[model samples]
Target: MNSTTIITDTHTHLYSEEFAEDRNEMIQRAINAGVSRFFIPAIDSATTQAMYNLEQDFPENIFLMIGLHPTHVKENFEEELNHVTKELARRKFYGIGEIGIDLYWDKTTLDIQKAAFKTQIQLAKHYKLPIVIHCRDAFDEVFEVLESEKSTDLFGIFHCFSGTYEQALQAISYNMKLGIGGVVTFKNGKIDQFLKQIDLCHIVLETDSPYLAPVPFRGKRNESSYIVNVVAKLAEIYGLSEMEISAATTQNSKDVFGI
Candidate 1:
């Protein structure tokens, strides 16, 4: 790996209000820092337009994914799924994503969340694109859904992956890559200790920006440029050069998203 090679932020949220004041400037900073690729995950209907605008503003830097987020899943999930399907039919999306079961925030909608997740998985299969998952305190539930839908066509990333080594292996078995982000750099973020045992080929860099900012920037709003810190952390943990980690994860992201 060389400094000249570009690093990809496999998962990020540039559409969030956190970047409203200087989204373009933040993106330019990221590009200047050698972090060029941006994979944007959809939250719900409310973000579609903003996502589209971001893509139009920086077509080459940003790629998009379409799907309903689990936290937003409710009795009206059918309508949300309809929006996702319509978007997929209307144009192309890099992947079907930010989709999965999240029980951490709300457990009341578990059943509906599962249904929406499964439906999105089916959609990913139908479109022949990878799926980007958002799992939270429901790895078993997520694995159950993947188990039911397991096939060569089923694959994607476990975004913001903070699961145990065994769970990470389980996710890989389903053809999914682990989306490593800010948490890996936390003091108590246990993943760093065992991550070296995992191959870099199965990893991808992400920030989940506007949410989990990496250390030194922790508790503050995150942005794409902050992904450089994530790359540096992985380099330290894996005992490899920053360029090595960047190249390997960027390649892994390309493999998963077919970019």
Candidate 2:
């Protein structure tokens, strides 16, 4: 990738404590590689202030999204939602998200998870902001909420989408662009096989980093800079060049985030 080419990690948690020792250097490595725009996803109130702090340090490059992650939606969900409400009212957020269902972790909280998801969707619509969805082992549930809430007002990226081809189409039907990341590059990652069938317009790039690192870096701590590996995989998958994939995904990110 060239210095001029722009890349966006539409879903990343750069504020995680994992980057405490080398956060500055890690960010610079990404910037140097042209992974310029980072849309940070909030897990819950605990990370909200850290997100604010990170964005202030890199005002021009980092974008923030406010929400309570599905896994974090436990007993105090109502209170957490209130916090999300207050935070959005305080300032503009790129989206309301990293929010959705995660049955893989805790099935008992499904009811509360669904409730939180709906509330945040309404919040997104009320604020007229896009939402970044986080769906894991709960595609059916996620699609169901999206179905009930479907409207022109609802749209955002389906972060780390690695579902079947039909599910990809279904997600797009809900006004969501699939967020492709290192999973696309994994040897066993199936998305690469059919991602080409999907149009570039509905696909955005992400690292989901400090996790989901592409092969060669797989099983290792991933970073935004490794996003180029994803770009290379996408280039191969789409029958386009690396530059083409980078530009297309970056533009797709702008479209979803309204950046």
Candidate 3:
């Protein structure tokens, strides 16, 4: 119910080493720019502590999620999942996230990735928390697992959504909100052209910071403050003012994360 110019970065790696030098200043800049809520995703066990630290540092502004990212899933994934499970039981996380299939990196681990993805989806349902998914060159693979697990209880964000309109509808049918990020502002970022056809309610803003910086800051290390670029792009795409896009998408994020 906060009446500020709410802009929520539904996905960001504040725990990334790239921001170690000036994380606090960068966060303050974003806050001053009205980018209030930040949702942090877990990459692996290695980043859990940093994620927790970010929350402690900005408990009211930053929210945390727990999961093993696709690229981080390895042969001994059972141990990694055990870590996720233990953490979920030990603390309250906003979501079970940054989880899904990624064939763009290593296809050899597809089976293990599918298993881990399925396991996390189940975990998310068990805890009644939304999920944040990461998909890359494996849309069909990700969709197949989601189809098998689809249910009224299954809902979350399709982080870094770069799929077609048909795929977007399919993702929505499965109760997933598209996590639009800096890529939406890229010149060749095709999704921007057709995003207007999709409902804004099914969209959420993200920076995926320390990576995928929007135009003017594109190709540079991204920070949460750069979300202003994303909001501007969305305003152009939707033919609405920046405040309109910010308010609508921030509400969409709250609906998903229950903030």
Candidate 4:
């Protein structure tokens, strides 16, 4: 946490119910620690309104992305996708995101997830917005879609990226920036071993709040403020100061989110 380095939580669910009690204070803590920007991702139609309300609350600090998350793609998914498209047409969003293939929860829906993921990638390109992908237990599937959609226009962060070094290179090959989070700080989070080999320009910071809290706070409720822990880990991995990590990643976020 450097006084002059501005930090950005490239992906966070500050609108989540987990912060229902002291959301304001939690955000303030992050801001005080130099994490001034919060990019909020849409889970599905259900969370869109909350996302809007969050943007209104901190219009200057909170940036909203529109998309239907992979895990939420299910029966009647067409209706959900409609909500995403309709909302995109209605207003401006920072990006089209929190979208990708996730087979961890229910492997049965893999096909539908890929369809939805591709549709949203198209939406992102149409809107000229970056995409924040959420890949879980489906790297091969996710990369396949990305490979098909590969173009100068298809670019964004691989949200909560947890993959091998080769996969990291492959993601960058598709014009994606890795959204590093709490996992990088885990002792068994193997990515730490080779993350340094990847350029800092390919990385961005995130908390995925209410989910992956960094070390020391691992297993606890994650908050935007905990992003400092992630930054610290990256500094160690990349052999840079916390300020350098924060500054570079914050700039990388601006590059991906376009703000």
Q: TM-scores across all candidates?
A: 0.98, 0.99, 0.98, 0.98
Off by over 4 Å in 1: 1-3
Clash pairs of candidate 4?
A: none
Per-residue CA lDDT of candidate 4, range 1-259, in tens? 5578799998999999999999989988888988889999999999988988888888889999989999999998899999999999998899998999988899999989999999999999999999999999989999899989999999999998889999999999999999999999998998999998999999999999989899998899999999988988888888899998988898898888778
Q: Which candidate should be chosen as best, given lDDT against the real structure?
A: 3
Q: Candidate 2 — which residues are off by over 4 angstroms?
A: none
lDDT of each: 0.92, 0.92, 0.93, 0.91
Give the top-scoring candidate (TM-score): 2
Candidate 2 lDDT by residue in tens digits, 119-202: 999999999888889998999999999999999999998999989999999999999999989898888899888888999999
lDDT of 1 by residue, 1-259 (tens): 3549789998888999988899899999988888889999999999999999999999988999999999999888999999999999999899998999999999999999999999999999999999999999999999999999999999899999998999999999999999999999899989998999999999999999988999989999998888889988999989998888888998898898888
Q: Model 3 over residues 1-259: C-alpha lDDT tens digits?
A: 2347889999999888899899899999989889889999999999999888889999899999999999999988999999999999998999999999999989999999999999999999999999999999999999999999999999999999999999999999999999998999898989998999999999999999989999998889999989988888889888999999999999999999999
Judge candidate 4 against the unseen true structure and give its global Cα lDDT, from 0 to 1.
Answer: 0.91
TM-score of 4: 0.98
Ranking by lDDT: 3, 1, 2, 4
